[model samples]
Target: MNRTWKNRGIVFTLALLFVTVEGFAQGNNNPPPKSPEVHGDQRVTFRIQAPNADSVKLSSSDIPGSMFSRHMAKNKEGVWELTSDVLAPGAYRYRFEVNGISVIDPRNTSFSESNENIWSLVTVPGNPMMDTRDVPHGAVAEVTYHSESLDRFRRMHVYTPPGYESGEGQYPVFYLLHGAYDSDDAWSTVGRAGFILDNLIAEGKAKPMIVVMPDGHTGPFGYGDELPMDEFIQDFKNDIKPYVESHYRVKANRENRAMAGLSMGGAHTLGIAIPNLDEYAYIGVFSSGVFGLVNNDGSVVEASETAYVKQNSEVLSNDDLKEGLELFWFATGKEDFLLDITRATVTMFEDYDFDVVYEETEGAHTWLVWRDYLIEFTPKLFK
Candidate 1:
C-alpha cells in the first residue's frame, strides 16, 4: 500500500507496455504475433509465439470438428497461425498446446475460469441475446466479504441494473450461483449474466434487479470427489445473503428474492432454496440434480441415497412450503451430461406434487446453454 511500491507497480506496467511497443517499433518483424483476430465474416484467426516447439495445435471447446485440436502452420519467423471456419456469435474459450504443454494466448487479456484450468476468451458478437448492443449497461462489481461460517474471506460479483445507482427504489435481489470448478467470476464473465440482464431490462422483458453471483466452490476437491456442498449452502445462508441484503438496496421480503444456478450450482440452489422456501419465492435449476446418491452406472449408494430420501422428506411433503412459491422452473439440454440428473430431479418434484415446469432444449452443458437459460429464466422472476 506504500507509495514506493505503488510507483514501482506503475513503472513495471509501463515497462511491459514499452517492451511490447518497442517490439512493434522494430519494423517489418512479426515475431510477437497479434493473436485471436476476429474477422467480419465470423472466422477467427489465431496466432501464437511458440517457435521452439516441434508442433503447436489449437485446443478449444468452441472449435468445430472432432478433438477440437488442429495443428497450426508455422512461419519462417516461428510464429504459429491458424484460421478456423466461421464460428457462431458467442463467447468461446481456447488455449494452445505447444508441444503438448497447454498454454493460453499471451495476447488476449479476456479470459475465464474452466474448472481446474484456465482458458483465454474470444467473443464473436452476432446474436442479439449475447451481443453487447447499444443499450444502457449495468455495473458488474467484484465484492469481497468475510464468511463467518467458513472463517475466511470470500469474493462475489454483484450486478446492479441500469439506473440502480441513481434510482432510489429498492430492487428485488436475484441470487445467481456458478457451478463447480468455476469461481465467483464465471457468471459475470463467460456466463454473461450482467449483459443478459442488461439486454432484458433494455427490451422491457425483465425487471431491473440486483444479481448476486456468489462463489459456490467451498473446498479444494477434484472431479469424482464429494464437494463440500453443505459448507457452501451455509455460507450462502449466513454470509453471502446477509452481505448483499445489508450493503445493497434490496427488498427484504421473501417474494422479492429469487435463487438459481447451473450444474453444481443447481444442486446448491436445490439444497438452499427448497429447505428455506420462506426466503426465495422463485427457484430455478439448470442441468443438475441431487448428486452422490447414485453412481455413474445408475446404482444407488445405500449410504447417500437412502439417507437423502429421508433427510428432506418432511420439507418435500409439506404443502405449506409451496404457499408463497412463485415459480419452480428447470431447464436442461438434451445432450447435457447432467440430463439424467435433471430428469430425476424433475421426477422427484413431480412425485412430491410440487408444481414444477421443466423444459428440455437442444445442446449440452455449456456456458452457451446456461446463458440461454438465464435469458429465459430471468424474465419470469420477481413477478
Candidate 2:
C-alpha cells in the first residue's frame, strides 16, 4: 500500500508540473519571438511580430547602403522575417524599417552610436581579436572632466591596460578620437577600442598603455558648419591634456604620446597633430583626409578655412620635426569615398619631404575596416 501511494504521488507531481508548464507557456510570461538569430553558417535571420504592418525592411551598416535593404516577409501569424546573406565575422549595427518608418529591433538590448545615429548592435562572434577572451582584462572608465575651454563638463572614456591598478610604472598614452556623429563613448563601444587593445596587449603584440578617447564633437548637437576643429583643439590643449597629465600616470612628453582618428576625426588628427608635430611621436589617420581643404572638382585648396597648410608651413618644412615623428601613417579603403582626399594628403606630406606610410586596403568606410586597422596599427606603437 505504501509503494502504491508513493507511485500515485509521483504521478500527481508530474501532472501538476505539466499543468504549470502548460499555463506558463500559454501565459504572459512567454517572451516575444527572438529576432536577429545568427546561424552556424554565418547568415542571420531577423524576425518581428508586426501583425498590422504592410511591409518591413532590414537595414544595417554592414549592408553597404539602402540599395541592399533586405525585405521581410510576413506570415499568417502576423510575424515578419528576413534572412540575410552570409556575413563576415564581426559586429554589425542594424535596424528595422516598418513601412518606411525607421525603428530599432525591439528585441535587441545592445546598441551602437554611429556616424549620424544609433543602431542596434549584433555580433556573429568569429574574430578573436574583437571578441572577449580569458585574459588579463583592462577597464574602461567613463571619465568626467571639467573642460574650461567649452565652459562645461565634458566626458571621455579612458582605458587602462591590465595590471595598471597595481603597477607603479607610467604607460604611453594614445589619444584615440572618433568620427562625426559619435561622442567619446563611441570608441569603447561601437569601435571596440578597449577589447582590441586588450587582445593585443595579452598576445604580447602591443605594449600595455592607457588609451584616452576624447569627444571630438563639441557642439550642442550634431556637426554643423561651425567646424568643431578650433574649440576641440582648444579643449584638448587647455583642459584634456592638463587633466590627463595630472590625474593619470602618463609619460608626459612627445615620445610617449600618440594620436589617431577616423574620418572627421582624421581631419582633426591632421589639424591638431600636424600643427603641434613636436608633441606627438605617432599619428595615424584612417579613412579620411582634410575635408574642407579638398573640393569635388579638385581645383582650389583653401586647406581648412584657417589656411592650415600655410600657417603650419614652418613645421611642414622642418626636417628635424619630421625626424622626431616616428610614424605619420594614413590608411583608407580602396572603395572609401574619401580615397582621393587620402591620396592627396599623403602626396601633400610627401611634397613637403615628410615621411608618410600610406596603406590602401580592401573594403569601404565601415567600422570593421577601422577595427582591423587598429588591430594592425597599435602593434607598431611604443617600440
Clashes per prediction?
0, 0
Whole-model lDDT, model 2: 0.80
Model 2 / residue 172 / CA error / Å = 0.5
lDDT of 1 by residue, 1-383 (tens): 54323643553344345335444554426546787999999989998765555888889865565146999998776678999888877787887877787777778878776554566788888878778989999999988899999998877899999999888999999999888867777887778788889899999999999999988877675878886688998998899888998999999889999999998889899889887878889999998887755578976454325555577778788898887889999999998888877777777778788899999999888776888899999999987
Cα lDDT tens digits for candidate 2, 86-171: 87777777877777766667667777755435667777767888888898899999888999988988878899999999999999
Error of 1 at 94 (Å): 1.4
Query: Judged by lDDT, which candidate is best?
Result: 1
lDDT of each model, Cα atoms only?
0.81, 0.80
Q: Give the TM-score of candidate 2.
A: 0.87
Error of 1 at 230 (Å): 1.4
Q: Show the colliding residue pairs in model 2.
A: none
Candidate 2 at 176: error in angstroms? 0.7
Give the C-alpha miss distance for residue 177 in model 2, angstroms. Answer: 0.9
